[model samples]
Target: MTAGDPGGLDFWSFVELANRRLAEEYGFKHQLATELLLTLNRASNIVTYDLEASVHRPHGLSWSGFRLLFVTWLAGPLEAKKAAELTGMSRAAVSNLAKTLVADGSLNRESGVRDGRSVLLSLTDAGHRDMIEVFREHNEREDEWAGVLSPEEQRILVMLLDKLVTSRDQFDVRGRN
Candidate 1:
């Protein structure tokens, strides 16, 4: 539906019809593929937004900034590219986020010792202490979100998602086939 449409469509009805049409008209292998992906996308947005507002923002960290610090804290010092790969963020984003974190005294970015062209990121002492406290609160938030599902249901969902995500070996960050 476009913005120029005369009437608004019911979301559930629209999705149900769209999936049926995909199966009938396009011969889709999975009729609910679009619906499943859309749900997952929405879930991601909701979780991230909630976490940022409740956990990260009060700590003076953006979501990207928090991820950078978290990864650096978990793994020791790492080059920007490695940080990007671990956090699923772009190298440029890691760079920009790292600058703010470093300026805030939460992270330290320095020229690589062995490779002068590379820059390494590591959490400062304050960052390490801060993250430890933030993590306690973060775990509580995680429990709140997961509590929506039964234990068995949550376990099954994790298993299924892991299988689907890890099954894709044909692609990489560079978009390689």
Candidate 2:
């Protein structure tokens, strides 16, 4: 199919074609791993984009911003380093996002009690209210996404994903926290 053709092939079709081509031309093997990783990444991106567009952007938050706010709202007043670890974001990113959130009156940043150079972040009163409202909508969207599968299937998927995540230590792969 031509690359510019709009209705030529769907995603799975493209993946299948690529797999066949790679196997034929490059002697590539590992199709199962390739397919699994591609499907996982695609699903994550689709859900993240949908959630950002439908739930977060209207409230002036990106996925990252919402994530920062979500973690802090649920588990503040936490050090920025802790927030970064929980959010799977870098410490520098947490610092920068905190500045924006603080400027918007949605977060409070204070000096750490034990260390002068450390920053502790917490949601403000308005931040708490906003987070509750936003989280209600967020959870509703999450429910809609999760509704595609049966409860047992969802449980199994979660278990499998957790297993994959926890098994990272078995390999030398470096990934987000």
Candidate 3:
């Protein structure tokens, strides 16, 4: 909101100004952590929005829908509970989305063989075919994003991210297996 602030300002400018304000007003000592999380979240949102808008939406899928389909396509004929875990979605969400997907002929929901109360979800033949095509486009966009970084930088970034994920246990934070 200062002289050089372009209206809402840009992400980096906001981060810079925020850190300065927090330091001046509160003597905040967590600026590094704040910046790291803000950058990571912004990057994630940007990439997710791009992929959903460009690749998934054109193929008639929302981000959540694509995630459900992708999981079923890969490890399908599995229980809805398992799919929920793999996709990081709630059981009820997966169940609801499954109804829509099934209605669209992209997914099939059936009673579990062992437990009649449990639901099993799988990609239909057409769904499988569509996923193959969509994933190709998805990977191309992923490659374009990765292309911005040198291979070594990419590798290091992945390693660091993996380390952070793996470290969740240290804080008693549970995550998908």
Q: Write the residue-wise lDDT of candidate 2 on 1-177 in tens digits.
A: 434564778999989877887788788999878988999999999999999999999999989999999999888699999999999999989989999999999999999989999988999999999999999999999999999999999999999999988988988997654
| Model 3 CA deviation exceeding 4 Å by range | 1-8, 174-177
lDDT of 3 by residue, 1-177 (tens): 343645877889989988998898779999999999999999999999999999999999999999999988888589998989888988888989999999999999889879988988888999999999999999999999999999999999999999988778878785543
TM-score of each: 0.83, 0.94, 0.91
- Expressed as tens digits, the lDDT of each residue in 1-177 for candidate 1 is 432353666667677777877787778877567888877888889899999999999988888888888899998999998999988887778888888888899998899989999998888899999999988888899999999999999999999899878877857634311
Model 1, poorest ten-residue lDDT window?
Answer: 1-10
How many clashes show up in model 3? 0
Question: Which candidate number would show the highest TM-score if scored against the true structure?
Answer: 2
Question: Is 1 or 3 the stronger prediction by TM-score?
Answer: 3
If both were scored by lDDT, which would come out higher, candidate 1 or candidate 3? 3
Instruction: Give model 2's clash tally.
Output: 0
Order of models, best lDDT first: 2, 3, 1
The reply for model 2, stretches above 4 Å from the true place, is 1-7
